[model samples]
Target: MSTPSQLSTNADLRILQRNMAAALMQPLTRHDGLQSRTQVDFITPNDRLSGFQRLEIYARQYWFRLLDCLYDDYPALRVLLGEMRFHKLCRDYLAAHPSTSWTLRNLGSQLSAFITEPKARDVARVEWAQTLAFDEPQKKTLHIDDLLGADPSALRLGLQPCVIALRIDHAVDHFITAMKKTDADVRSGASQAMSQAPTRAAIIKAPRLKKEVLHLVIHRHENTLYFKRLTREAFLMLTALRDGLTLADAVELALAEADPTTDWPVQIRDWFAEWSQLGWFCKPSPQP
Candidate 1:
């Protein structure tokens, strides 16, 4: 460990390692550092594939597995592109985008942008949304009783992870909505007409369990992302509260949205009932 020569050798080795990695990354072309010493080992006459071949297997496997994860996550995008074209897309993507993510989950975070290129925008819009829908968080649900005298001071709201907030343009939103409404009609011999009007429907935030269409915050009771949609007003109220608004203030905001004439107390009661039923709020029962 104290040898200066060894230290110098290590620095040289690191430089060489970087160069070697770069060469392997690029197509079979020459690079400065990899000039005459192109490969680590030369292929012997009898040996068909060299040591580099054996080493490359690992690199190939890494790319394949990561790409496979992307495919599994973005099947809709793949379908839109078709098999051969999808393969080309993956090829072009991998070479240009190298694996920059620490986890495969993060791998496709930018895939939406990747597919949003001029040629791929149409399908990218669909695929990116799907990917986000799949990865959104799931939180523990707060039962109905938790919404009493909801004081923001000591209250902590547990939000469902699967709850997505999408602000889509009218055209894409409408296209998606129309697709959903026509699933049954499509099979029933109804003629299809297409129009660009934005409709917002929750994608499959929850994978299994009896409930599937998202309109609310998504939670995982045991295994699936179950959603309980909140009315727009209620959602806004919670948003304010979650961001540190006092219970009284949040209630004021909520009551204002309900109806100018509706009694605030009554509105709060009714809203609490729904919030509790949806398991959207959790109150800490034990006092300090």
Candidate 2:
């Protein structure tokens, strides 16, 4: 319906809009803004701002918005790294892996791999799992009665959608708990006096994190996420079940790896009962 000139003009406008959007998504800089301005010839200068300056505003906002989303997703990581380092981490991560999803909730999905420090990466992994568990689709939880009539040896249990098993080198769960407590104290009036005291020079000292393997099960219940510490044997057992191992095999593996001095059979029985009551497992899949 349009003339050739009008069609050509419309095509040019589309190209310019795409170029401006791509520029805005990149990290903002004077050089980048100047390069981006060259692609769009139609932007007009206002009394208060030049055309490039206006474009720069959008560029800055784009970065800030994504940065804020990353910050919110990994608050404990920010606390561990401090403000400046965390900002640098976020900037470098964004540069390496830009958001590709429509939702900001997925902004930090690749953060664990992007982080260089092992401890920071572990924390990111745990936080990412928490996010995933929170958003996981709801499924019916399995109860003790569901397994009462079945042969325990042949049952292949399924884990709840909200369950996540992680093994990390540091006690990140404890660190997260401490950081959350500190934040809560600051938010309340309890820490007002301490906050008002004279500030000491910021010392860049790394906290002495214990270097030991920690097995953890993070799950959501009653709309709250709980971190449950587990022994190596128990963790292995759960992971085996999660990977579709038969109940007999998972139990045998866990018992074999358990401490000789401990009453593993009793311990496992209690653990299974407790976990089942807590809705950690889903309905067992049909026997093959």
Candidate 3:
């Protein structure tokens, strides 16, 4: 029923698909030309466009779509690296780590590891955590009443799925917050030409973030994301609980490295109440 040219086996089809995929994923030439490949085998040349040009359309679109996703995911990283550098970063990062996941949400999952600059790396890490926190599904949160009369020594607790804890050497959170505010203000000021100019200037003249050890919890509540700063001990305790340690043991481990002069008992109670209200705690699934 089929001619020889139209006939195909599984192997033939697989080779065709592989060739097309390679063409789409290959990097564009310096002048935005397609790299040398055997596109003519499968692609037909036309009067207006050659076979390679036709393939280049899809390749450029594919790459542009991916680059746009990285821009959306890592706005702060772009700001830190500047526009041109960010573009280079995206190309280099993609070359090293292509999109393997079905969803673009995981595209920048390895970006932090790829970045070499400490400041930029820290920003990338925070931005990536925010992305994850925004997308992660929320679970039933543990309220203060749920913990009443519970045995601290034996009861293990879980953190909300959206909670992401980070300890960084610089106040990158503050820097990002400032950047976001500036962006919002610039957008608002766009209506008033007089205000827009200064707002844009503020972004270029943004102050450098001071180097400090910051413990932060990025969490989402009621569909809004928040960054909550924590004391070193509280950070340790919360991370410990997230690691499946019982409350008493977690507290003990947290306090072990804390300042000796501080009244940790009162602090612990206060931290628990605050975190409970924030709905950061959840009940872990029982092990088999």
Best by lDDT: 3
Per-model TM against the reference: 0.52, 0.79, 0.87
Model 3 misplaced stretches (Cα beyond 4 Å): 1-7, 37-40, 181-207
Instruction: Give one digit per residue, the lDDT tens place, for model 1 in 1-288.
Output: 111223357776676566456545543212111123345442233367665654454344444455566555555445445565665676567667776756665565566567654324544544454444455544555775545565655555544443343222223333333334221111112333212211223333221112122223433333333334555566666665555566667766766647667565766668767656655454322334
- On the 0 to 100 scale, the lDDT of residue 277 in model 2 is 80
lDDT tens per residue, model 3, 1-288: 111244269866777777787777777676555787536457788999988888777777667667767876777777777776887898889878889997878899999999988888888888888877886877888888888899999989988888999998889888888776322111111121121101112124444777889999888877778888999889999999998899999989998878899988899889999999888888886755
Superposition error at 229 for model 3 (Å): 1.0
Worst 10 residues of 2 by lDDT: 183-192
Q: Which stretches of candidate 2 lie over 4 Å from their true place?
A: 1-14, 30-38, 181-208, 284-288
What overall lDDT, based on C-alpha atoms, would model 1 receive against the true structure? 0.48
Query: Each candidate's lDDT (Cα)?
Result: 0.48, 0.73, 0.78
Better of 1 and 3 by TM-score: 3
Query: Candidate 2, residues 1-288: lDDT per residue as tens digits?
Result: 111223358776676667777667666553334344343334568999877777666666667667767766777787778877887898789878888987777889999988879988998998888887776755788887787777767788898878899999988888777655221111111211121211223534445556678998888877678889998888989998988888889988777756789888788888889899878898655557
Given candidate 2, what's the lDDT at residue 137? 59
Question: Which of candidates 1 and 3 is the stronger one according to lDDT?
Answer: 3
Question: Candidate 2's C-alpha lDDT?
Answer: 0.73
Q: Candidate 1: minimum summed lDDT over ten consecutive residues — where?
A: 181-190
